[model samples]
Target: MAEAPTDPSHPAAFWDARYAEPGYAYGEEPNAWLVRQSERLPTEGAALVPAAGEGRDAVWLAQRGLRVTAVDLSREGLAKTGRLAASRAVEVETVHADLQDWTWPVEGVDVVALSFVHASPLFRAEMHRRAAGALAPGGLLVIEGFHVGQLVYREVSGGPPRADMLFTADLLREDFAGLEVVELEEAETVLREGIYHDGPAHVVHGVFRKA
Candidate 1:
């Protein structure tokens, strides 16, 4: 967990450089936790995925008959998402924009997937707020991110080094206040996604329904 640069020089540069290389930074498969929660998601509806790098989760949802729109800062990553979606014969609308400034559609989606987004504390709340507001009535919000306890794993965890960026069940509850929480918990799990994220990790998982 290295501290990200304080200067926000289009954070896209940081991610673009990483994604410009061959292979997905977080692997080509959908996150395991997200996969487990997918059973609860609507079979066919619009979904909004923020920080959807390489679009793995978005592609999976699209394949399941959901219309998915994946937003990310990195154009390179979104490009890979396009290729991946094409390979899977699914359609995933890709939007390359900074989450901090991106205008979310008003009650425009049926699901919001926050699979391992790990945004900084400065933007996390706003991001969650927008995600929540973007959801249509009764839409689902699925989240899975490194827990603050993951700090103990240090570099092995491969997430933001700043504790503020890591989450706790309480923090998520607050971030998504107003939503009806159906599931919220923290636990240790093995993550074998890609070269970027693979190890024993402490994480928080949540499922909130827009009231």
Candidate 2:
């Protein structure tokens, strides 16, 4: 495995190289958790997908009749997302910007979908804040990531190796104190993607609604 970048800029380059291939690094399907939680999304509202690797989930949201914006640090990843959106005949806004530094949309979003967005501790907290703040009243925040216990099932194949980068329900609850928890649970599920995350793994999935 490539060493985790000591400098923050190194991660963009790392992800850019990983997404340089012709196809998406994680395939074209929306994550199962996101799919399962789609029913909870508002029908007529804007959706924000941060750290959206290749627009699969964004495209999926667009198909569900929601206006979507997909954001990622890697230009290459955003390019792929645009291509996929075009191919799918879906109109989606693809933004290539670092989540930690990007200017968030001033228009409150109705839903924010954060899937497997593992990053440094500081960035993670900022992302959580931004995600929660982006939502309008009665909006939803859907998140899924490798939990701390996932290390036992999948070793180091998925998510950040630094334990601090991963999430726990307690951390999420603390970060989203203003929101009402709709669903939060940790479960062992089969992650079917490419060679990277193909196995039974532990994950934390949560849905919170702003009051």
Candidate 3:
């Protein structure tokens, strides 16, 4: 992946430019892995989605009858999310903010879902902590993204080119330390979402439940 800009406003500016391009960066559908794990998700509850680019995952959650909140740094991306929600006849609350600096809710949501948010290691750890803390009792957190092994396929993996941003099963277990690991694994798979993630890939998929 490209390096996030260093200037304070550059991250948003950069993402705005990216999302401002022609089509959805990833796609307009929920992640395939998330779809497979949907049975564990509550049909009606509040969900928080961080780094919800173009709101596909967030919009999908809303379609499932959940009140969903999607937070992202790019205003343009959120705008697209709103349009997508309108197109789907669903509602997704879009929040424009930087995850690195935002205060994550504690015990306030029934689900927290993150997909392919490849931030720098420190911010990534913080986001994981926020995700774990956001869950209410018996709440679930679903995260799926590129495995560290994807570095080998950087040319076509569609993951961050940086190894620190990529993940391993152990990394996730450590990041979400307090949650109960309902399922955690890493494997090879094919991603056929959009122009962004379209190829064979190595990935990690996990579901953690709060007690």
Candidate 4:
């Protein structure tokens, strides 16, 4: 994967260093599957993107007229987000905080986008549940991430080191219990994001709506 997260003791520092690199660590463009599901997003409303690394997705949402809040533990990542947002002439509220401790806006947002966020198994369910709780009635939560099957890709893959950090449709379905499942699938896709995430990837993609 991408350099096996250097400062594991302080994951934020690791991410900050990665984002502090010369160019967008994962590329300037939003994740391909996210763009594909954009039509399902609210036309005008609030969106919360946790672990929003470099703001590609947040910027895209803002461009489409959604008020977006992009949160991450890495200050450098959020700073890159600000730079990218400004470059695109869009406004994205950047929050620098660990998602675990941040006060999520409960039932206040219209959408939540989680793309390639590799949460450890211990935190994954809690994270997804909180994100789902933040959605308003009928609000949507769209996610795309590496599946456990991605382990086969090994060094060529771009996901969490531990298999538990990966995702499965069943896991997500159980985690988002109160939401109606609009879509869920595990599949293989060719990724073209940047140096960090470029290769064949096994992924889980899902779109769930709050009841």
Candidate 5:
């Protein structure tokens, strides 16, 4: 059996190697929720996608006529995203930076999209704050990730192992205190990734609008 890749010490390197393969790590399409919510997103506004692995979401947003800036620590991932954007004939700004240390834009982004970005609790809180602070008034923030119950399915440990790393509706509500909670729910979904996440999983999806 292949060993699970869960080393938090060098996530950039791990993900970089994982994405160095021939194709996208999570497929070429965008997340289902993002596609469904595209109508709600502003057509000509800037979007920030932090920890944007392989840039699927960012590229999709760009294709929808949104100016997108995607940041990821992994060079390999950013390269793949750039290639995808070029192939799709969409423009996107790609940045290679670690979210924990990189400076985020202040009060300009119309949307901040975080999809399946797992981090330490402290870092996660900081990320949430940065994402919230980067948004302009009435801007939208979309987040989707696994919840605690996700550990029960498939036994395929791919996400953050610490339960604290998993998100809940209450946690999001608390972290993004001033945002209007447009939608929040816990649901079960199947991730159809290549060799990594391919099974049933419990997750929390949220959409918040800055007040």
Candidate 6:
């Protein structure tokens, strides 16, 4: 079993184990929500994907014509991402780092898409603020993850072990207040990412645009 996030230490082990499994923990396909938001994803310019696992989303974005950089704490996962990118014949820059401490450039990217990156309350807001700061004007941030309501479905869908680490629409609005709310909502949805995340789950998804 993967270790629960004890950040700066445990998360690396946790994710590394998950990715070292027989296949991609979240599958080889891009996130379904990300695919739905593809029309808005920039076909050019730079894109950043933090907490990228197995490079599914990063490779997809690269195939879409973006110069993509994928960041993750697990070297194993990054390696898988590199392999996946090569299999797709696309280029993706991989960075080994923790998003909580990593400093991204201001207005340095045209797109920032994150999926299932559950942050602890201790630095969740600040992390989100940093994500907002990384966006150039008119840049879009597409994100989705288990909502606080996922607690009830935890056994079935599997999300952050701690409720405090889960998100709500209100919390996201407050954290990313600097960005315009293109779409924000909490809803019940079915997940079919991989062996781990498969069930009817409650999630909060949003698309925020920098003005």
Against the unseen true structure, what C-alpha lDDT does each candidate score? Answer: 0.87, 0.82, 0.87, 0.88, 0.85, 0.88
TM-score, every prediction: 0.94, 0.92, 0.94, 0.96, 0.94, 0.95
- On residues 134-197, what C-alpha lDDT tens digit does candidate 6 reach at each position? 9999999999998989888877777887889899999999999999999999989988887778
Q: Which residue segments of model 5 deviate by more than 4 Å? A: 1-3, 154-157
Q: Superposing every Cα of model 2 onto the true structure, what RMSD results?
A: 2.1
lDDT by residue for model 3 (1-211), tens: 3233334437788778878988887889999988988788889989999999899999999999999999999999999999999999999999998888888899999999999887887678887888899999999999999999987665664777677778999999999999999999999998877776777889999999999
The model with the greater lDDT, 3 or 6, is: 6
**What's the distance in Å from true for residue 137, model 1?**
0.8
lDDT of 2 by residue, 62-153 (tens): 98888999999889888888888889898889888888788886438988998888878877777788789899888899998988887665
lDDT of 1 by residue, 1-211 (tens): 2324333555788888878878887888998877888679888989999999999999999988999999998899999999999999999999988888898987989989998887777888988899999999999999999899988764665776778889999999999998999999999987887776778889999999998
Worst 10 residues of 4 by lDDT: 1-10
Top candidate by lDDT: 6
Write model 4 residue lDDT over 6-111, tens digit each, in one string. 4447898789878888898888998888888867877799999999999989998888899999999999989999999999999999999988889999999998
The list of candidate 4 runs beyond 4 A from truth reads none
Q: Which pairs of residues collide in model 3?
A: 1-160, 1-161
Over all chains combined, what TM-score does candidate 3 have?
Answer: 0.94
Looking at model 6, the pairs that clash are: none
Pick the winner on lDDT between candidates 5 and 6. 6
What's the C-alpha lDDT at position 38 in model 3?
76
Candidate 6 has an lDDT of 0.88
After superposition, which runs of candidate 6 have C-alpha atoms over 4 Å from their true positions?
1-9
